[model samples]
Target: MTRQTGAGAPGSPRVAGAPARLAARFSARLEKWLEAERTQLPLWLPVGGVAGVAAWFWLPAPAAWQGFLLLAAALALPGLVFGRGGRIGRAVALFALAAAIGCGLIWWKAARADGAALPHAVVAAFTARIDRVEPLPARASVRLTLHPLMVAPDPRGGAIALPGRIRLTVPLEDAVAGLAPGATLAARARLVPPPSAAVPGAYDYAAVAWFAGIGATGKALAPVRLIAPAPAGGPSLWLADARIALTAHILSELPPGEGGVAAALATGDMGAVTQDDNNAFRNSGLAHLLSVSGLHLTAAVGATMVLALRLLALWPRLALRAPLLLIAAGCGGVVGIAYTLLTGAEVPTVRSLVAALVVLAGIALGREAMTLRLVATGALVCVLFWPESVAGPSFQLSFAAILSIVALHELPWTRRMFEKREEGHVRRLLREVAALLLTGLVVEAALAPIAIFHFHRAGLYGAAANIVAIPLTTFVIMPAEALALLFDSVGLGAAFWWVTGRALALLLAIAHHVGSLPGAVTFVPTMSRLAFASIMAGGLWLALWRTRARLFGLLPVAIGLVMTLAAHPADIFVTGDGRHLAVRAPDGQVALLRQRTGDYMRDTLSELSGREGDEAIALDDLPGARCGPDSCAATLVRGDRIWHLLATRSPYRIDRPAMEQACAAADIVASDRRLPGWCRPRWLKADAALLAGTGGLAISLVRPAVVTVAAMQGQHPWALHAAARPAGAIHGSYRRFSQADEARHHSRNRWRD
Candidate 1:
């Protein structure tokens, strides 16, 4: 009777079965999603790898134990998840494993280098072997990579063992002009740590310097003298020699500007290109052509393969017996390797070479050479071998350009468009032109956001510029240049070099003409890090996914655009040295406190404010401002309230009348010197000690009475290692300002003057 009563309840059976049914439905959905995503595992791997590298950079310098724990967790979580869980877990496991590999790789790279950096701002004499020399155009300096043999304060003292490399900017006078790699040199130099980020979210020169094994940067205090002939110039030195020799030959053969472009194309030496030419290339969106990257690698390799095949066909005896395609691909691989070495084996060149090698390998294996899988494999290899590349613009932009091109070609609509047959010569020609334009548009669209994010500028005429530039470079210039280089190697290619120079002159002319057009470049203000991240994520999603889900990626893109548009420049900006200050006037023009000092910082601030020129008014010209020999006092009117600011070079000197007047007038005082104890309680001071830790500051006038501030170094990795400055100490003084005013008024007013 009891069993019957329980079973007879109709709702009981349904409720008991509900949990089982729901579980089945959830499992089925997860399986379906995983099946859909299975083909995208390669795409996800790079994403995870990038995330791992970014996480490492974002974190403070981790201790040995912490780094080890991260490596362990990154490795172990995937195995545990895959072993115990379902399809969804397996996908996550794959991503986790890739991330783990990335984390471990970077950790290992960092761990292997145990040498400490040179003490900052120390002047000493060092005997160093030149590893590399880069000549600066339009400057009387040569940048030398030095391997220190000995360092001392005085040449007579015992040598100090210095580890790692030093980047020395030596004056290119008689003593150093002939300097080349492998030469030993002695010089007195002042070494300092690499410069910190110029502004918030700016480039991290310190991290880049650290990863490059360059512990410090310096300028020679004395003329560098050759101590000895370079000790057995190694393979790298030979390569450098060859590049320099090739560049010199090219320059000798062609016109000044034209020769620079030709040499840059041939030997990866863009240093000779003038600043005006650089601006033209940048504005015309043809700057990538100046660098040896995927385009150069592909063109060179493809030309080598085609020429090899053609030559083989001419000799039927060899063509019949040999696998011409495979042989050609092998030849192409060799050429790619040679070119990579010639170009200094830079990260971008290496990446391009790897990808080209992968394709050549595929051809050698009798498989299709071009595929997303191969591209992903090349990127993963680059990341594993050089983890620091993940933080670089070249790696990001190169990969982005390649991935976007591949993704666009794989699109169903684009494939269908290409599959259609043209009926006539004119129609086919039109189709070819359309294809070229489409390719340029796709690459430009992918790179535009990134360029804006980093450089804060976009080429308005980039598409039009590329339409003419790409075909000319790809078909005419690069092919001729390659042949010229090969012929010049054996000393018989003057005609080819002449042709290449002509083509380069034409290319430069195009760049100049395009760049000079109205509104050729648009300057965008800097955006938030989060907004940039979202934009990048959206771009990756759109390029990586093959399904309709890619449409969802547009959401983040829109949000990023909105965020960027709404962003505002800071009202007041200060440099880390506490020597430069910029305040936005009511009319929105940026006014400088010191007109001469901090030109770069001021120009950057002006660009961020959407100003076209680097024009700044003097502090003396502003209303309610007074300037003395060493200090300046100004009152800023925001809305209905007046906020006073005092900037002084000598905080130690207390001129009675000036000090009293400043105290009565100013709300904030910034100086390079430490503030006096008597005045500290009354005025808000940003002294040298504070500026050192903060890097820089941006103040926002929230309202007439309320103000908010943000620091450039806020929560960044560099700040984590920097000495902590107490903002509370400065704020505390303000709290007791009124209470302590009467007690110290008379004594505090007694200035030295």
Candidate 2:
């Protein structure tokens, strides 16, 4: 009648065996999941390797020995437990091995790229060979990347050597003096070490430059003297000459705007394209067309293959004697390689080239094509050869777009849409349209997080734009352009050129119309690494996994989205030199500390503050700001606390009484020069010395915290160089130009600068 004893109770035996029961159930489910993912497991090898590369990049100061040790342990793991553990164990070992290899690859690559960085800013006259030239007509400048052959002796009879490649921004007229690759030049330039990130979590151009073997960058003091003409011997020189010639021919055939776009599509030269067109393409999500990646390369290869096959079939003897499909595939492969090389062989183009070649090989061998395995192979090759590329947007976005498309089609439902079936032309057309739309949507969704992470904005209507732009470019413009080039030698390409120009005009019009639509671009605040990592992990899980378990990925993806939405930007943004400062007022509008601001500074601050579209009001214009000749005092109210900020407007010292009173009353003080001992801020003192090491500052009022680029970057080599200025030398400025900007400039010069 009363409570039962332990052994007699109904739940006692079950409780006693719960651990064993749970273990058995878990093992059964694990084994089931492993079997379903057996084929997919190899696909994750690249993911693991990329993760290792990311780990290496993110670590404070990762060492080669660490990578080596990790790799050794991973290789020995399967061997150590051979025939002991089940499928789960083997999978773990495989992933670990892949990650270790990635880490090791980056370390080795970094070691090779390492060189002595410029000590500090110096005005030295040096003779150098032009490795590359970029024409930035928009800025009226030409950027030259050079390998120093000799440096003239210092005025004081001292000597210095430019250890690695250096980039100089020269006046457009000056660049014309010696503006070709492989040409020799002599010029006096104000060279400084590569700058660090402008803001925490912003793109680190310094890291990229370091890996690219560029130790210093500067501006030319005067026009460069042509020491020697471009010597034509090397393959690089030949490619450069050919690319320039081709771009020039296309430009000459077409009108200004259309010609620039055509040249970009044909030869990967975006130099002549106006910024307005660039913006439209970006906003409309048609930006991918401008980038010579999967879509362009695939279309080129496909066109070549089809044309070759048709021409061969015309000769019945050759068709009957040869493996026509293999021949076509071989033709496609050659065209893919040639197109890639002609397009400058950028990271994305190269990645696409490798993938296209793989697909062509599959066609030749009659193997399953357009699968995740093919994508994995392409990714593996990229990570192996250019492991650092895994961290860049080009590699991430290119691979993600392809992976998503392939994965979507791999689904049984989607595969049915592509499989041949008997139907009316209208019905078939509708199905194809729907499939393209679906693919666009899938690609848009897949690329959103990465786009937002790198650019702080994602195209909201990319799918809709791509629906029209893709076919327009692939079928109409590119093919027409190719044919025009082909018949141009016989002077019969005028009509074709006209057709290509018209198609391009339509494409540009579409981009402008779609990009101008409301909410075409969705701007988000700077996302934390953790949140981005979560989204990446979730996306990979969803895309890679085949079973219902993949739905679990939605949890992390949702969480990451929420985290991103909830993230708040810092209240104040300050440049390292204290020449520019921005603050968010109590009214939620950003205010500038100075009356004037550079375009680069303004845009960077806007993006960092998550208000890309908003115009910044000057400090004196704001209600709670008081400004004078030497400094500006502003009030930023967050919740119940009011923060008093005193920012210097000029290098000259302010009035003693005014400075003392401002410092005494202020909660934060920001100046480029050292402050007096008697003047102190309650929260932080961000002066020249402190900012030098930090590179830039993002101040938060809510928690009263400061996040520096140094802290965000940790003790990486690129970051360390910012704090290593030589004695009596001028300090290097914060990031002045992004790699993308430089690349655009270089492209302009690469082809008829």
Candidate 3:
């Protein structure tokens, strides 16, 4: 009664207890969420690993010791969390540890992959042993993966050290006889360092090459002389030789256009496929069929298992003595492994093979297969070994598509809706079609953002196209090709080959027709990393979570799409070498400063601006543009300002006086040659000196700023080439491990160890 005057007021009991009640409620909710996500824990293990790999790639020049320190800290997290925190803390700690391990592994791989960087390009004669051979019959060339043995002395009277591996595009006439792996050859070639990104924030081919252990690329200048024939040894060599033979056999047996598709499906070689065909497939959403991935692997394994089971059933005594299912599973797994190895063992194929083998093992062990868990396991394994692949489109697209499909099937309602029951044939067929349609739509939606992020476009009709394309490729083309290959040895495969060709022709026709439909492709301007990241996060959330709370993921996804739509693409674009320039006028039309530039450059510019190459009009055709033989002057209006641009067309000598006057009057200048200080523009002077430092240039008048490739690509080992530095500045411990240098200096090659 006395406390009621102060602490114990009339409603004090309810108010004071409110805090405790809220705390209890919050704790209960968190525990409920945890319980709900209990089965979802394993899925996040790979997510953490992928996040770690992504962090490594995105961070600028991460030190090895830093990763080790992070690993140590992450390892200690579990102990501290276990002692002081609850289940949620323990889960977070485990996830942190997985991320740290992923980061550490990728860091180690990157360090190991580091090799000598070529200071500058040089055309010289070199001797190298071929490590691999890729036939590009469509391009009238053969690509050789070479291990450099010797290079002729440079013009400055010094030996040139080549990297451990280099790719040379040898013309059909320049390629030597028996130009296969394990053969040594001498050739004149233009050896150059890996090319950098074309524009700011574009794809970094240099980084990809670096991770692949390819330090340089070149084109053969003259015919190569084979010093030695291919040795009849090495498993990789045998595979390469066999792949070449298989590709040739497929192409030889089938008709021309259809054979390229056939060979691609059979051997995972797309060199024979023409650019037009590739584009058609890509636009029609049938491009995945060309890539030997989970679909092909599953089909092959299933076919083999069915055939094995049928054959084993014929031998009733043997079938009784052994478990037929286990035996069939074993046979299927063996055939799958063989096929994977035969087809180059690419990342996607290997990932599929791993999952297939796991499923087969589950069958043999009489265990239920958890599809989503199996996908997670395969992804985690691939991330552990090929961490760099996490950054690639192939890895992202394949995993995203599969995860979405599996997650769709994992939903309770989805299972109920598709549950098998006694029904008429028409009902069953309709149910199957509906299931396929739903799956295709889910996969397409999941893959759209990724496709747009990489290709700057998404196929609108992909799902509809796949309804016809998939069954044609799977049930007809794959099985026919398999039978054709089997019967080829007995010289009775002609009929099967004809069937295969007809199926492929129909597939290609479907692709072309679908691709030609109006609005088949939706082009999007280049999106920012943040937008892409948000989309990725939301997609993972939606795919990983099984509860209704997963619907919350749509918030970030919608935000990302809005951001992408509201983005403002740069109005001015310049190549890294300053040899090309493009300007987008106020009317939303683009014009090229040079009419003579190649199609590749034009296409690149068009894609970046979210337009087709054919849609870009000539600079001279623009209303406010005037042109001459060696230069062009243009005016662009953005917002309230009028900007003037002067761009030189020729790389050779220009009229210096006229250029200087024009530069003084213009707001922006672009030239391939080094310009004098007096020729400076008011805003930008994109001459050789400036372009060398910037790498590439993208100017946005709306933002009134410029973005450079060098700035976007941070100072990584692969990007050091883009930095303006002396040629001799690149001589470091990394180059000391070069095979060519080690042979002469007789020093330790730590890379080998």
The candidate maximizing lDDT is: 3
Write the residue-wise lDDT of candidate 3 on 1-753 in tens digits: 356635557658777888999998987787688788899888889998887887776665556447644764666576465635455665676677778878888878877885556778888888999988889987889999899998888888888888889989999987767998899999989988888888875677888888888988999988999999988988888889999999999989877789889989999999999888988999998889999998899899999999999999999899889899999999999999999998999877998898789888888888765478888988998898889889888899989988998899989999999989999999999999999999999999999999998888899999988998888888999999999999999999999998998999999999999988999988786788789988999999998998888998999999899999999988989988888887876666778878876877887887787787778888889877888777788767676556677888775666677666677667678888888878866567777877776677888877676777776666566775445642223121011112342232223211100
TM-score of 1: 0.86
**Tell me, what's the RMSD of every candidate?**
5.1, 8.5, 9.7
Candidate 2 CA-lDDT value: 0.80
Clashing pairs in 2: 134-745, 134-746, 135-745
> lDDT of all predictions, in order shown?
0.72, 0.80, 0.82
Off by over 4 Å in 2: 1-17, 63-85, 586-588, 721-753
Model 2 root-mean-square deviation: 8.5
TM-score of each: 0.86, 0.91, 0.92
**Tens digit per residue, CA lDDT, model 1, 1-753:** 454336447657766788899998998886776678678766788787776776665544466425744664765576565646566666666677677677667767866754346544677887888889876643556788889987765555754445479899977673554578889889988887766654454455766776777777888888888888765557887889888888777778788788777777777888788878987898899999889898888888998899999999899888889899999998999989999999888888988999999989888998777778888888888888888798777888898888887888888998887655947888878877888788878888888778877777778778778888877888998888778877877898888877888888899999999988988877775576678778888988887777787888999988998898887656666655677776777766777777675555666666655554356677777766777668877767665445567787544576765575665545667776666644441445666666655555555543311121223323333231444563223333343234344344434432221
| Worst-scoring 10-residue span by lDDT in model 1 | 704-713
Runs off by more than 4 Å, candidate 3: 1-24, 61-85, 725-753
